[model samples]
Target chain A: MKKLINGADTVLEESLDGFAAAHADILLLGAERKFVRRRTLKPGKVGLLSGGGSGHEPLHAGFVGRGMLDAACPGQVFTSPTPDQIIEAAEAVDTGAGVLFIVKNYEGDVMNFTMAAEMTGREVASVVTNDDVAVERSTYTTGRRGVAGTLIVEKMVGAAAEIGMPLAALKALGDEINRRTRSMGVALLPCTVPAAGRPNFTLADDEMEMGVGIHGEPGRRRVRLASADAIAEELVGAILKDLAPEPGSEVLLLVNGFGATPLIELYLMVNSAKRILEGAGITAARFLTGSYVTSLDMAGVSITVSVLDGQAKELWDAPVHTAALRWGT
Target chain B: MKKLINGADTVLEESLDGFAAAHADILLLGAERKFVRRRTLKPGKVGLLSGGGSGHEPLHAGFVGRGMLDAACPGQVFTSPTPDQIIEAAEAVDTGAGVLFIVKNYEGDVMNFTMAAEMTGREVASVVTNDDVAVERSTYTTGRRGVAGTLIVEKMVGAAAEIGMPLAALKALGDEINRRTRSMGVALLPCTVPAAGRPNFTLADDEMEMGVGIHGEPGRRRVRLASADAIAEELVGAILKDLAPEPGSEVLLLVNGFGATPLIELYLMVNSAKRILEGAGITAARFLTGSYVTSLDMAGVSITVSVLDGQAKELWDAPVHTAALRWGT
Candidate 1:
C-alpha cells in the first residue's frame, strides 16, 4: 500500500500529537492518551463528548472546541474506544450542569459509551444518531450507522450547550435532530487500512459501491459508475425519500466527501443535490459542502438532508470555533 | 479513471454552478460563465482579482467572498483563463481605489493576467507569487511555480484590502508575503486531468515523486517510497533550506494536502514537520492544516513556511469570511 505513515501502530498517536499541537488553543491531551479535551473548562456548563473509530476524521476529534464537542476519545481505525477512555474524558469535562454523550448507532460505540456514562458517577444523558438511511443493518451497526449527520448534531447541540443548556435538553435536542436527518453515500473506490496493507475491497475501474458506510462496511450493492449528476441524483433521491420533508420545508443540506474526492466533484454533487431538492419543492435554506467526515482515502461522496426546525437554523448558524467547523466566533 | 464528472467538457460550468449555488450568500456567477464574483461589490474599496486554471480548487474561486478576492476567473482545467474573462472580472469589481491582480508564476497565468491588467484601463497592480522552491524551471513555468504560498498572499493581502489598503499597497503586501514564504511537496501517485481521461503520469507502486507540481508538472525527481517521517523530514528540510530563516525566527506553518491525501496522513506530516522545525530551533508561532489548495486528485502533501511579522500575523488572524477560510469573525 502506498500510504504515508511512520507505522500502522504509531499512526493514531502521531496523528493526535499533531492535532493537539496544531490546535493548542482549543484542544489538549487529556489525562489519558486515547482522548482529548477542550483546553479550558467553562465552569457550570454541560460537557459534550462524541467519539468512535479513528479513520473517520474531522469528526469527533476535529469537532472538539468552543461551540462544539468538549472531549473526544478516538479508538484505533475502525475500532471502538474503550470505556475507560470515555470515562476519563467524561470526568475531565464534567461541570455542575452535567455531561451528554453523542453516540453513533453502532453496537460497540453504544456499549462502550453506555458503560462509560455509568462509570463517570455524574449526571449524564446520551443520544444515539442513526441518520444513515443507506442500510437498516450493517456489519458494525444494528439499525443504521451514524454518518455525516453526526456533524449536524454536534454543531447544533454544542451551540445549545455553549449557551448553558442543561444536559437533558441537549440530549433531547440531539435526538430530535437525528430524527429529522437522513444521509446516503456511494464510493467509487475502497480505502486501504494502514495495518491491512490492502484495500478493504476492490472495485473495477468503472464500478462503484452504492450506500457505502464510513468504515468500508458493505453498501447496498455495486453498480457501473455513472455521471456526477446521476450519482448525486441517486444519493439525494435516497436521502430525500427517507427524509420526506413537507413541500416547501426548509432544510440544511450537507454534501460530505468520502475522502480522496476532489472539491470540484463535491461542488458538482452539491449543485446536483440542490437542483434535485428544488425540483421537489424543498428549499435548501443553508448548505455545507466539504470533507467534513471521511473514510480514509475513499473516493466517494455522501448526501445529508436535515429538516430545519425553529431553532435548528439558529443553532447551526451560531458561532462555532473548532478545528474543522468554524464560523462567526 | 474513476471520477464524478458529468462530461469532461462540462466540468467547469457544472462545478461553478454548484459552487455559486452553495455560496449564494457570498458568491455569484459573473455575466460571463468564466468568472465568479462577490455578490455585493464594495464600492470605493480596492478590488482584488485572481484567476487561473480550474483544477486547483478553493484556490482562486473559493477565496472569493468578503475580506478576500473581489472576483475570481476560472478557466478550463489546467488552463489559463482568457484575458477577456479576466478583464470583465477586473472591471466589474474595480472601484476608484483600483484593483490588484494576484497571479501565479506560471507563464500562461502571468502573461494573461498582465494582458488583462493592461486591458482593464483601471489602475491595476499585479504580484506574481513564486514561492515554490521545488525547481528553478519546470514545465509551464520559467523561474518558479506558484504553489500553496498564493494562499498566504491572498489571505494577508485580502485582509489588508478589507481595511482600505490601496491597490499598490495590497500589491506590495502580496509581494512581501510571497518573498517571506517557501513551499515544497511530494506525490505518491499521479492525478488524472478530467479532460484527459487518464492518469497524468505513471509511478511504480513503491515509488514517489518529490517536488511535484499542482498541474502534474514533473517534480524534482522520483525515489523509492519511504516512511512518512522520513518524507516529512525531506520536505521540511528542503523548505527550511530555501527559507533559511533566523535561528529564532517565528514562522507560520501551513501543511496542505494535494486533493486525495487523507487528514490522518497530513496530520502525521504536520507532526513530523513541527519536530524538524523544533530541532532547528525555529518556533512555529501558528499553523494551518487542510486541503486548502489542491491539485485535482493528486495524492500528496505540500509544506509551506512563512516568516510571520507583526503585520503578517495580524492579517492572518484577521476576521475574514470566505467559503474556504474563516476565523474569528
Candidate 2:
C-alpha cells in the first residue's frame, strides 16, 4: 500500500508526536501516550472523554478542546485502547465534578471503557453511542456501529457539559442525542490500514458498498454505482425510515467524507440530500460538510441526520474551539 | 472515475449551492454564482478579493468571510473565472477604501484578473502569488505555479486587511509574504478531472511525482516512492535551499493535503519536516495542517514554509472567521 508512514507499527506514536507538537497550544500529551488532554483545566467542570481506534481521527482526538472532549485515548489503528489508557485519561481530565466517557458501540470499545469506568475512583458515568443505522450487528460491534453521528453526539453534549451540567445530566443528554441521530455510509473504495498493508476489502470500479462501516467492514450490500441523487435518496430514506421525524420538523444534515472523497463531492452530496429531505417535508435547517470522522484512505461518504429540539439546536450552535470543529471562538 | 457527482456539467453550481446553504450565516452568493461575498461587508476595510477555478475548494471560496477575502469568484472546475465575474465581485465588495486582488500566477487567472483590474472603476491593486518552487516554468503558466503557499499569503494579508490596512499597503504586505514563502508537492496518484473523465497522469504502484502542481501538471521528476521521512527531507530540503532562511529564523509551516491524503500522513510529514527544520537550526514556531487547497481527489501532500517576522507572526494568530478557518473569536 502506498501510505505516508515510516512503518506500520510506528504510525500511531509518530502521528501522535506530530499531533502533540503541532497543537501544543491547545492540548497536552498524557504520560506514556495514555491520552491527550486539554492544556488548561476548568475547575468544577465535568470531564468529557472519548476514544476508540486511531484511524478515524478528528473524532475523539480532534474534538478535544474548549467546548468539546476533555481527554481522548487513542489505540492502534482499528484497535481499542486498553482500560489502563482510559483510566489514566479520566484521572488527567477529572476536575472533581466527574468524568463522562463517550464510548462507541463496538464490543472492544464498550468493554474497555466500561472497565475503566469501574476501575476509576470518582463519580464516573458513560454514554455508549450506536448511531450507525447501517447494521444491527456487525463484524466488531454487537449492535449498530457508532460512525459519523458520533461527532454530533459529542458536540451537542460537550456544549452542555461546558455549561456545568452535572455528570448524570450530561450522560443523559448524550444518550438522548445519540437516540435521535442515524448515519449510513457508501464506500467507493476500501481503505488500507497501515498495519495491514493492503485494502481490507475490494470494490470493482463500477460498484459501491452501501451502508459501509468506518473500518472497511462489510456493509448492507454491494451494488452498481449510481448517480449522487439516487445514493442520497437511499441513505436519507433509510435514516428517515428509522427516525420517522414529523413533517416540517427541523434536522441537522451532515455530509461526511471517508478520507479520499473530495470536499466538492461532499458538498454536492449535501445539495442532493437536502433536496431529498425537503421533498419528504422535513426541513434540513442545519448543515455540516467535511471529513470529520474518517477511515484511513477510503473513498466514501456518510450521511448523518439528527432530529433537533430547542435545547439541542442551541447547544449545537454554541461556541466550540477544537482542532477539527471550531466556531464563535 | 467513481465519484459522488450527479454530472460533471453541473458540479460547479451544485457544489456552490451546498456551500452557500451550509455557510449562509457568514457569506452571500452573488448573482448567477459569479462570486461569494461576505454577508456583512465592512464599510471602509480594504476589500480583499481572490478567485480561480472551482476544484481547489476552500481556497478562493472557502476562505471568503470576515478577516479574509471579502469576495471570491469561482469558475468551472480547473478553468479560470471570466473577467466580468471578477469585475462584478470587485464592485460588490469595494467600499470607500478600494479593493485589492490576490491572484494566483496562472496564465488564465493572471490574464483575467488583470482585465478585471483594468476594467474596474475604483482604485485597485493586486499581489499575484507564484510561490511554487517546483518548476521555474511549467504547464499552464509562464513561471512557478502558485500552490498551497497561496493560502498563507491570503491569511496573513487578510488579517492585515481586517485591521483596515490601505489597499496599497495590503498589496505590499501580500507580496512580502509571497517573497518569504516556498512550497513543493508530491502526488502518489494522479487525480481525474471530472470534466476530462480520466486521470490527468499515471504512475506505477511504487512511484510518485515530486513537485507536482495542484492541477496534476508535471513536476520536477517521477521517482520510486520513498519513506515519509525521506520524502519530507526532499520536499523541505528543496524549500530551504531556495528560501535560505537565516539559521535562527522562525517560520510558519503548513502541511497541505491534495484532496485525498489522510490527516495522519499530513501530521507525520509535519513531524518529519519540523525535525529537519530544527536540524538546520531554523525554528518552525507555528503550524497548520489539512487539505486547504486541493486538486480534486489527488492522494498527495504539499509542504509550505513561510518565514515569519514579529508582525507576520502576530497577524497569523489574529482572529479570522471563515467557513474553513476560524480561531480566537
Best by DockQ: 1
> Which stretches of candidate 2 lie above 4 Å from their native place?
none
TM-score list, all predictions: 0.99, 0.99
Candidate 1 lDDT score at position B317 = 92
The residue-by-residue lDDT of candidate 1 on A1-329, one tens digit each, is 88889999999999999999999999898754769898988998899999999988888899999999999999999899999999888888887788899998999999999998888888989999999988999999889999999999999999999998888889899999999999999999899989998999989988999999998888899999999888888888888888889999999999999889999999988888899999999989999999988999999999999999879999999998889999997
Query: What DockQ does every candidate get?
Result: 0.85, 0.80
Tens digits of per-residue lDDT, candidate 2, A180-262, equal: 99999999999999878889999998999999999988889999999999999999999999999999999999999999999
* Model 2: per-residue Cα lDDT over B1-329, one tens digit each: 89999998999899999999989989989999999999999999998999999889888899988878899999898899999999999999988899999999999999999999999877999999999998999999998999888988999899999997888899899999999999999999889989899999999999999999999999999999999999999999999999999999999999999999989888888899999999999999999999999999999999999999999998899998888988877
Candidate 2 Cα lDDT to native: 0.92
Q: What is candidate 1's CAPRI-style docking category based on DockQ?
A: high
Query: Candidate 2 chain A: worst 10 consecutive residues by lDDT?
Result: A54-63
- CA lDDT of each candidate? 0.91, 0.92
